[model samples]
Target: MKQGLGTQLRHLIELLDGAVQQSYADAGLDYRPRYTPVMRALAGGQPHSVSQIAESAGISQPAATQTVALMLKEGWLVAQPGPTDARQKLLRLSAQGERLLPQLQACWRATSAAANSLDADLPYPLSETLAHAIAALEQRSFSQRIRDAKE
Candidate 1:
């Protein structure tokens, strides 16, 4: 039986993330690919709120919050109360995270090269396809499409 679109997409993510995770493990780094976006969002060494990280990282707010919590637990990030709004927290990379940047950046470069190689094998680049799909969805959400299909 063929997999559904959602299942296929999830499997694709599993394949990509699994390889990256293994590479990090092989490099003796305690890191997750999911954390990369957050790290990048804070790479400038400036503290940012969860919403800011979410927007910068192109992830949802909940995902940013969860990743931030995990990074904080691992000592990869530190958080302080917002200067103006004490109720909000601002987060930044910890010393440990800063020390890991050189290695992480190298890994990111290698990952990008690998992705480009993969894209070369395909007629259409996966990155561009994804971007186009996202744009289409933004113009008309999947839910709206589904409703239209029922009509």
Candidate 2:
């Protein structure tokens, strides 16, 4: 069946999300599939404020605050006074969380490989092109959401 582009992209998204979420679970990490995007945004080893996390996570500020509070309680993150703004709090992974990063990264690699293996017969370039196209669409969706909220 020749699925529509949106349907194909949705399937790809579901597959990737499942793989990543399962990888984290298999590795005994605190897995929040929705938070994966947030993790990626903060993966550069830079401290980000809670509002930054919310923006990057595509979530509400209250939601991000709740999640960050949970992560903090779990000893995965620590909060400190922001360098530029004393009123703002900087959030960074704790030493334990930092140590777990390598394992999580390995899981990501393994999961990605498994996803590729699912369609080994397809040319890799085709998949890469599809991914780029879908990413563009997602960006547009995000923009539209922001625009709608302004009305």
Candidate 3:
């Protein structure tokens, strides 16, 4: 019995994330792979709202909010009242996050190199495949497929 596409995709993500998390640990950094996007978005030293972070990081607002919460708990992020919109909280990296930037950048470079190598080993590069799949989904979403199937 073969696994479903979703199961295989999820398993692959878990494997890759686990490997990267272990690498971060080995480098004495207590960082999660999922935090990378938010960190990168804040690395520019400009304060951004959760919505901005989500767009810049190509993630969902809920995911960005969750990551922001986790980062705040870890002291990696700080939120200040938005200059123009007092109601909106603008998020930025804390001093600790700034200090960790160098180490994080090093890890990012190594991880990118490793991913490139992995891609070279594969017949079709994972990145390109994922991009194409995303594009295809955008053209015809899974929800539409289910709706079509029901009829």
Candidate 4:
């Protein structure tokens, strides 16, 4: 019984994320790989709305909102009412998050180096493979492929 592509992809992500989380813990920093994008977005010192963060981070709005909520609870983020839109809230890194930046940046550099080493060990680079996969999916989505297969 062979595993499906989606399952394999998910397993790979889990494996990588687990390693990353452990590395952060080892460095005395509590962070999740999922938080990287949102943190990066706020690192520029500009406050952003959920939608802006979603677009900048290439994540869904709901995901950004959820991440923001968790970060707020964790004291990693601070939110203020949007100046123009009273209903919208602008988000920025909290003081605690700022304090963690140096350690996080070190981890990021190490992660990049590790990824490069891993890519060198593989026949095809993971980043390139993912880019190609995304392009192929954009050309013909998996949903369309499944429908075509049923014909």
Candidate 5:
């Protein structure tokens, strides 16, 4: 499985993410995947513009803009004009979004517990093995991107 390094990593990531997304959807919220990444972007303690959010989330600017508009309509996000640049708007979570923090936290805990329960004793030095795997995969991705850009 690891021999096809980059492909294996992509597959694993998609599988895990799909499981997590389904879990979130089962929790009875709208549960858009964008919500989680957007929240993570806002975690940096500064309001983000749609472009910034898109870049951080690895999504397209038009998609981010659309999602932000939907979120605003759903009362989960608030937007204000940028302090220095009136043309740009800043995005942040609204009071309703803040109130959902506990729900999000609980969902994360449940997801972790479910995954951990699958193999409590996988029988390996997890940190080193996982760290090495991650580093190797990241390097592979970087190299591939560089190669692609050169082509």
Candidate 6:
């Protein structure tokens, strides 16, 4: 049986994420690839709320919240009460997280180089394809396409 587009996309993600995760392990870094965006968002040394992290990371708020929780548990991040809203928490990198930044940045560079090489091997660059797809989706969502097909 042939796999659908969603299945294929998921398989691709598994392959990519697995390789990156392995690289992090090989580098003796106790980090998840999922944590990269959040780390980058907080790299400036300014504390930010979950909503700010989500916006800075270009991810959903729920994703930011979940990642922040994981990071806090791992001792990679610390949270303090928001200045005005006690219910809101501002997050920043812990000392351990700060110490890990250089290594993480190096890994990121290596990953980018690997990605560039992979893109060169492909006829259509995956980054460009993803950007194009996102742009199209912004104009007309997959749900709209499905409705049109149904009609």
lDDT (0 to 1) per candidate = 0.95, 0.77, 0.96, 0.94, 0.79, 0.96
Q: Candidate 1: where are CA atoms >4 Å away?
A: none
Per-model TM against the reference: 0.97, 0.58, 0.97, 0.97, 0.59, 0.97
Worst 10 contiguous positions by lDDT, candidate 5: 118-127
lDDT of 4 by residue, 32-117 (tens): 88899999899999999999999999999999999999999999999999998889999999999999988998999999999999
Enumerate residue pairs that collide in model 4. none
Q: For model 1, how does the per-residue alpha-carbon lDDT over 1-151 read when each residue is reduced to its tens digit?
A: 9999999999999999999999899889999999999999999989999999999999999999999999999999999999988999999999999999989998999999999999999999999999999999999999999999999
Query: Can you write out model 2's per-residue Cα lDDT over 1-151, one digit (the tens) per residue?
Result: 7998669879988987876777788889876666555566567889999989889777889988888887788777888998888999998888877888788778767866875776586766556876786698677875686689999
* Residue-pair clash count for candidate 4: 0
lDDT of 1: 0.95
Clashing pairs in 3: none
Scored by lDDT, model 5 comes in at 0.79
- The clash count for each model shown is 0, 0, 0, 0, 0, 0
